[model samples]
Target: MKLYVLSAGAGLLVGIIYSLLNVRSPAPPLVALIGLLGILIGEQVIPVGKQWLSGTAFSTACAKAQAVNHVCGQLPGRQQAGQQAQSAEEKQS
Candidate 1:
């Protein structure tokens, strides 16, 4: 997001300078507005930026978390471990 915003700002500054160089002779409002919008959108859509996160970020995160929980939660309890023959003998003594 920061990169996108910065690029847009630089584009706007350049646009302003270029417009001034033309003496602002009957400057078109729509042209400036549309140009700025185009620059902003281009900044976001282009791979030159890391602003937009991957679409799979959230989905992959969710799957990893669920897998971790499933593995942890299904693990044998200490009580079950202690019921093994060696552990049971130790406990009985």
Candidate 2:
């Protein structure tokens, strides 16, 4: 939720900058795609940074950040698969 709010705020700032510069609201498709990609990667920075600061292994930090999931989003049936995995783990425990 906080991440969403921050994302909206960043977008609002960019929109204001664009308006002041007389740039169009929606940039060209290539430019927009690049920007969206940057946003996706940027969102992982803080989580990774925090883990790094705490001395976690780089691979572990990346796993905790779930960067791929954040960028590509959940696939079809991913939630159910994850739940089943969790249940299996609990059964083992």
Candidate 3:
């Protein structure tokens, strides 16, 4: 998500400044970042859940969830494409 990227960029910028100043970063660790990402995803799930509960159709809710999955690079299609590319590279080699 844009929020995650912006947060990461800000953290990186702050980290560089901290290194230049020879001071420890006050920022949380990578684990905390992962936890924050989980929370962000969990928050998005609520809306899809509400849509499902309101009988808006499973496909619609799934589409919303799939968008998140795709953005996170967890989609099977993406995985297959990577595998195909790797196979092609191996064949050429």
Top-lDDT candidate index? 2
What Cα-based lDDT does every candidate model obtain? 0.55, 0.83, 0.71
How do these models rank on lDDT, best leading?
2, 3, 1
User: For each candidate, what TM-score against the reference?
Assistant: 0.27, 0.61, 0.33
- Order by TM-score, highest first: 2, 3, 1
lDDT of 2 at 6: 89
Model 2 segments beyond 4 Å from truth?
A: 1-8, 19-23, 75-93
State, as a TM-score between 0 and 1, how close model 1 is to the true structure: 0.27
Per-residue lDDT for 38-66 in model 3, tens only?
Answer: 65566567767887888878768867557
Which parts of model 1 have CA positions greater than 4 angstroms off? 1-13, 16-26, 48-93
The predicted structure with the larger TM-score, 2 or 3, is 2
Q: Over the stretch 1-93, how does candidate 1's per-residue lDDT look in tens digits?
A: 999998899967876876777735245788677666665545334332232244546435434334333333443344467568777799899
Error of 3 at 3 (Å): 14
